[model samples]
Target: MALGVWSPSLIDVVLFVIAAVVVWKLERRRRRGWATGRLPPGSEGLPVVGETLQLIAAYKSENPEPFIDERVRRHGRLFTTHVFGERTVFSADPEFNRMVLGAEDRTVEGSYPSSLSTLLGTHSLVVMKGARHKRMHSLTLARLTSPTAIREAKLLLHIDRLVRRTLDSWASSSLVLLLDEAKKITFELTVKQLVSYDQRKWIESLRREYLLLINGFFSIPFPSFLSFTTYGRALKARRKVEEALKEVIRKRKLEKATTRFDVDVNESQNNKKKKDMLEELLEGEAEGMTDEAVVDFLLSLLVAGYETTSTIMTLAVKFLTDHPRALAQLREEQEGIRKKKKDEEAALDWDEYKSMPFTQCVINETLRVVNIIGGVFRRAKTELHFKGYTIPMGCKVFLSFRAVHLDNEYFDDARTFDPWRWQKNAAAQQVGGPTVYTPFGGGSRLCPGYELARVVISVFLHYLVTRFNWEEAEKDRLVFFPTTRTLKSYPINVRRREEEEGA
Candidate 1:
């Protein structure tokens, strides 16, 4: 070896190689628990990558259930697998799922991929924890379900008007992508409820940005600065969404401040303005919540209200279309309500909306079959034990609602699109019990907008069945990866029922 620039000798090279191997082994063991028999039975797959590729691949295929089903067969309902750069426990058992969800903030906390957390922001309700999460969650639920909100006749009238207008536009269309139309209705409804903004151009543009943001939820989390990457584009979209929301908040605050005492008392009494969600949050129960928190909170609601509800609407229509008997029955029920109305233009009331037992059954069946949310990701806050298996602290736990919902053990003919099942089974009527049915999720994190979602979908279905007849424009299939949506947006050719009757 040269004095100034010495090359490694054989012993030194051997020792370095040995150290590298040891470190790699330790990392592998740490991730997979190679030395412990306590972790659930399963394989971690290839190091670093783990089963993420397989998971993604399976989800992209026509049937995504096999990924869990196959694993469950081999490793039982609760199994260990490394996915999304972490050691995760996938639970297919309804009892265990209930326990995990019930354990929120105590033993487990909300967890998601880095991509989702980044897009949703630290202040988002989905990622929020402890008292902060509890406060916001309660506030959101109260506002959404309050007497002045969804339960009000005015709000129900608004929803009916929006659904009617949307379907009216689709009446003359040669081709309609049901999913896109559903999104338009839901986005407008959510925006109106949130900020009282209903301008077509602004809602459309913001919805486009939201679509991009959603695309990145299941994408690679790092290297987000690269403009071309899906995650990168999603981040950009999120920023735009945040800025747009902030501007809305700014304008709203300004307007409120400017008009605080300037209104004529008589005029104000004659014309009472309904408070939107933004207004509610501004004067929120959760004290001292910042603008950023408000933005993130509203963004989360937008995602839930717009994407998930729209998807449900589309899937409900598709399922109804496929099962003609169910469709005929649903149409009859909706038409019965329509006949009782004063006139064709009269809007549905809260009582009428709640009166649709068959509609609720249809919505429940759609949620069960489609499993729009699929499951949730929860991180174990401490070492946990369940049914003799030990879950190490910090392990990601996936409560597979899809697995539970579709299990033949819980639901008879689980794969069938049977709305009548709800009518027969008493337990199925309760939508979020966690043990058997959890379409809107379970425990503390159950969706606040579940009832609202039902209302929106029910109203849409009422108008759709009463006014229009539609058939598929082309065959399309459901894709579950990233999100559950139709490959072709479920295009359909629709005709007004009056026109059809006249013909």
Candidate 2:
């Protein structure tokens, strides 16, 4: 970098070479230390500008998992990469996953691309680590996820109405734009889940803006200036949505509006008490959860809910379209559930929802096959030694599913789509636990809406599978999600088939 000693052309090459040497030295150090204890194996890849952009670009086609698989193939299980000068490791061992993603590891919780943090902002539980992070989780659990609230959430009229409207509009289309559908559903669901209906327009605008910012993460390369600009616009769009959300909170806290409280209430009363997720956020007993905190909280719920549910839905429909037999089988099973003894229908609440083991299996398998995030992230709380290698305390780590799901040792016929595998062949074992098959991530920071997601998917999918026919659009367009994979527009052929739809 010194001007007198080196010309710019020479400087670029010199700096790169030095970076390569540093990576080689660290890798050798890690590999040599492994004799003292066991360690996972992988590569840091080539050094370039203190980052792995080149490596990622070169390998992104069959990227993420392929990189992990290739590295694991060459380096074994646990391995280190010094790309960007970070001694990062991509480990597949379940125990290692436990060390990084499981609870009690705070040091490695918050190290990610700044763009990621920028996208998540302060409201996200994903980026924050330690007591504050855990506290945020607790605050979420305290009010929004309480048992009674879950039951009441089902009765939310706005959500029910929105879902009905959304579905009704889909009747004419041969192929529904899956991603758009999911965004609409997620935005409506989040608003329905987190805030009031008065701000539906703002919430919608926010969803669009977030989508743009989120899209920039993967489709666009970094430096993030463009993303920041998109984010700035999104911030403006977000302001409109936030205004509506904050207004509800302001109204709730200032007015102490108990008028909206009531079980099995008619529409009039529900409107007055603020029956949205925003209201529940307002109702939290946390000592100092600010309005901005509440706003961030609501925004995260929207993004998380939208990204996961929408992508999964797109994949499920796509998979089912490819595997017609499975689709037919699932339809039969759903029909059977409907024709069950009256007692069974009565029992088919949340408990019965879980009872649909086959349905759950399909969802689980789908997530395993198409995990949206390449891996789960964490940072070292302090310098730690696993096996024998010293992971300089504060080294960021990830337990990638890209490698784990495909590992032949763990999943038999891992590449095949057998929805019944979890129910029949693999029924004895659980797919996701503390460390393995972690699509929603793991530990105290595990996705809070996992259950809600399952429920909505189950119900929404139950309706789709039971009542309509589905097929891929004639042309399959690639959807470019910045940090996520969702359909840009999946035009699936659909048609309603009976008295259930009230023809």
lDDT of 2 by residue, 1-503 (tens): 37766786586689768866877777567556544543344544544333367445534343344555667778767776654446577677767776666545444655666545555566566666678778777756554554455566563333335555677788776567766786688666766566545366766666666666564332323333333555554444555656766776776675544543444466665456435655555555333778777776666666776777877877777788888887887777777776764753232355546556667777887777877654765666766577766666556676766567667787888877778777664544443465456777677776666666666666666667766775665766444223444455777777777643666
Per-prediction TM-score to the true structure, in the order listed: 0.91, 0.79
TM-score of 2: 0.79
Which run of 10 residues does model 1 get worst, by summed lDDT? 1-10
Q: Which candidate comes out best when scored by TM-score? A: 1
Backbone collision count in every prediction? 0, 30
The digit string of per-residue lDDT tens for model 1 on 1-503 reads 37435444565578767865776576677757634548889988986667999999998888888999999999999999988877789999988888888999999999888888889988888988999889888877777754446765277888988988888787466699988899999999999888889889999999999999999999876465577889889999999999999999999888867676566454664355447778878765425878888898899888888888988999999999999999999999989998988886888888898789998889998999899879999988888888899888778899898998899998899999999998888564475673578888877888888888898999999988988898999998888888764554999988889988999
Measured over all alpha carbons after superposition, the RMSD of each candidate to the real structure, in angstroms, is 5.6, 6.4
Model 2 local distance difference test score: 0.63
Candidate 1 backbone collisions, by pair: none
Candidate 2: segments with Cα more than 4 A from true spot: 1-51, 58-64, 83-85, 103-107, 145-148, 155-162, 198-200, 216-244, 251-254, 257-276, 283-287, 340-348, 425-435, 477-485, 499-503
